[model samples]
Target: MEEIKLNEVEPYVWEINKEGDMLVPGRVYGDKDIIQHLLDDVKQGKEWNALKQIKNVACLPGIQKASLAMSDVHPGYGFCIGGVGAFDVNEGVISVAGVGFDVNCGVRTMSTPFTKDEILKVQEQLADSLYNTVPAGVGSTGDIRLDKDEIDEVLLRGAKFSMERGYGTKGDLDFIEENGFISGADPEAVSDVAKRRQFKQIGTLGAGNHYLEVQYVDKVYDEAAAKAYGLSEGQVLVSIHCGSRALGHQIGTDYLKTLEAASKKYNIPIRERELVCAPFSSEEGQKYFSAVNAGINCAFANRQAIAHLARKAFTSVLGGSGDDIKTFYEIGHNNAKLEKHDVNGELKKLIVHRKGSTRAFGPGRDEVPEQYRAVGQPVLVGGTMGTHSFILHGTEKGMRDTFGSAIHGAGRAMSRKGALSCCRGNDVLRELRDKGILVRGHSIKGIAEEAPKAYKPVEEVVDVMHNTGIAKKVVSVLPLISIKG
Candidate 1:
């Protein structure tokens, strides 16, 4: 790999000016070293390299601002990981690449009143309890079984369905993004095949990068924000990271062929196969968008049910009531959401696609919960099992630039195949055990594929978020136990 050129527009910002068919310039957020690493990938002639994907996204119609990505940017199916592209509502296209196969794959963090010391005392028991309680791994099924009609209810109502089903309390909805379920989700828009896949899968944690973890706050960076968000040093937190499971994947798979034909029907240019899309107002687009909303609701319900399981695990192990644990925040990463943002001087509704990016709306936004509106929306960043995860807040600059988006995780430094060759499951398990982190998984290969060394340093990734004024750090948390799928 050799060095490639890019124009530095500002400190920590680089731009590939619009050319040929590009509708907007390509912008990236990273320091010189990080940018150089991306450039090296582009120089290597990798087909899906970050720079190429960013450029390809720029070529798409209706894109607003610039085709943007965070410092953790890396090659993805179409857009790079850490990508953000906001498009005009009327002229925009809703794409499957923008929302990965998992569909609303997200993180939900819960805070407990108990301190880390208390959790540490019962760590082993809690680990065992959660491991046995929450079903995980490939094709994992859970206690909640629903028929086809019931599956439609979950798709339509999301977390509300969970609360009504006694999976959680009603108050849990307030802390979730979009109040726990996206409205305008028509279950009819979702294919019957997709609904069938989710009958018994709701609440199960699917394999590959999905996890349920026990973590404790290790440090606080912003005292006021931390206080407002109800965090203190050594406080224990639980993070559930998964998505809509098989249903979402099937939606993406089913839509790809639908949109691929529609793209040609609509005479839309295609730079990448995963970039298949239909105009937002087109019949096909509206249906796909509605289906995506259903997928989003499925994920919300999935997390809500898992959160309930986590609360039960704590109550059973620690002799406490379920009310002791409260939801911190719940937000998705892979999504194409219709949101109003200031474009130039006027506010306009745009469909914002954040792939491997979390929405971090800054202070004063009505979308932010009233309790934390003065600070910002809570942004959950998931680190690898062996590293420290971070809690961050949205910044005004992020709203202005990256569509209120931030990195979702440390971008993969190696592929799963690459990692497996060098890291053994037992060896990785021994390493995490040495650090006093307990891990339980249904598959050893799953553990080996997600070894910490296979990912970039978490601190380095979050440093870019903090330095670029995208998402400010609130606190850092260390893992006590992780239940991996």
Candidate 2:
């Protein structure tokens, strides 16, 4: 790989000039140390060569202005993890690779009336209860079984289906992106195999990087924003991170094969087979998009069901009504959406694919929930197992600069293999316990794979976002107990 010329645009922003078929420049947001680390990764031939992925993304059809890579940028299927690219709807194509297999795999956080003092008393019991009530582990099935008709309703209604069935409150929907449901989902576009896979897994937390964490507010940065989010020091919070599970993986696998065979029919040149795509307006493309929307809804429903189970666990331990636990916000990082953006002084609707990136729409954007319209969309950034997570609000600068997108997580510094080589699962668990954190997992190997040393320091990543004006910090949280599936 040729040396990537990184121009320091600001304290936290770097730019790579357009080259080798790239239609626009590639931009990255990170501090000097991160940039150097990225360079080292490139030198070592790890696929996180974000510079190349950014350029590859710029070369995609109808990409406007620039291809933006967040500080968390790492190797992914087509786009890098933490990659953000927007293409003109009338002129662009949609690639299944841009949206990974876990369509709408995202995170949601909830605030609880309980405090650290109260939670500590039953921490172990809470962890055990949650693990039992919420189905987890590889290929785990739950009690919520859905037939074909019910599955269609779930795809159409998303979290609303669960809420109506007494899973959660209407307030939860108001705080979710698109009210937890993206319209235009066509269940008919979903394959029978995918449907069957989702039948028994509607409420389960699938394995691999998926988890449910019980945390407490560790610090407050922006007092006003923290107050608006109903967060205060020592307050308890629950975060659920998972995705569409088998249904989504099957959808991506099924459609990618179709797109691969049909790419020749559309005369779309293949720069990378993994980047296979179809014209946005084409029949195959539309069908795939519809199915992807259904997958997104599936995730919303999945999380809602998990939230219901989580509430039950909390009540069993805390002895209170479920009202004590209320949703803060839910956001999706995987998948693409049809959005209107200003491109070269002209506003055009486009299909924006944000893989491992969160939508950080600034204040006044209609998409922001009504209660939070003044403060901008909330951005949830999860750290490593024993690190600090942050709540950030979108900034006006972010909206003008990067199509209202921001970093999603700490991003892996080392692969799972590297992490396992460094430490054993039992040792990692003991260390976490020593640090005052309780952990429960379906497998010990899973715990070892996500060791804190495997990820970049989330604090540094958040600082880059703050310095770059992409998103401003609201508060910081530390984990008290975490459950991994």
- Lowest lDDT sum, 10 consecutive residues, model 1, at 1-10
List the candidates' TM-scores in order.
Answer: 0.98, 0.97
User: Which ranges of candidate 2 are over 4 A from the true structure?
Assistant: 45-48
Q: How far is 273's C-alpha from truth in model 2 (Å)?
A: 2.5
Instruction: Give me the displacement of residue 107 in model 2, in angstroms.
Output: 0.6
Q: Please, what are the lDDT tens digits per residue for candidate 1 over residues 1-485?
A: 52336798877789988887889999998877778888877777766688888888998889998999888788888888889988898998888888879899999999888888898788899999999899999868988999999989988999999989899965799999999989989899888999988999988988888999999999999999999999999999999999999999999999999999888998988889988989988999999999999999999999999999989988999886789799999999999999999989889999999999999999999999999899999999999999999999998998998888998988888899999999999999999989989999999988999999999888887988898788999999999999999
Predicted structure 2, TM vs. truth:
0.97
The ten-residue window of minimal lDDT in model 2 covers 44-53
Error of 1 at 321 (Å): 1.4
Model 2, span 44-90: residue lDDT tens: 77754676778788887778788888888777877888889888876
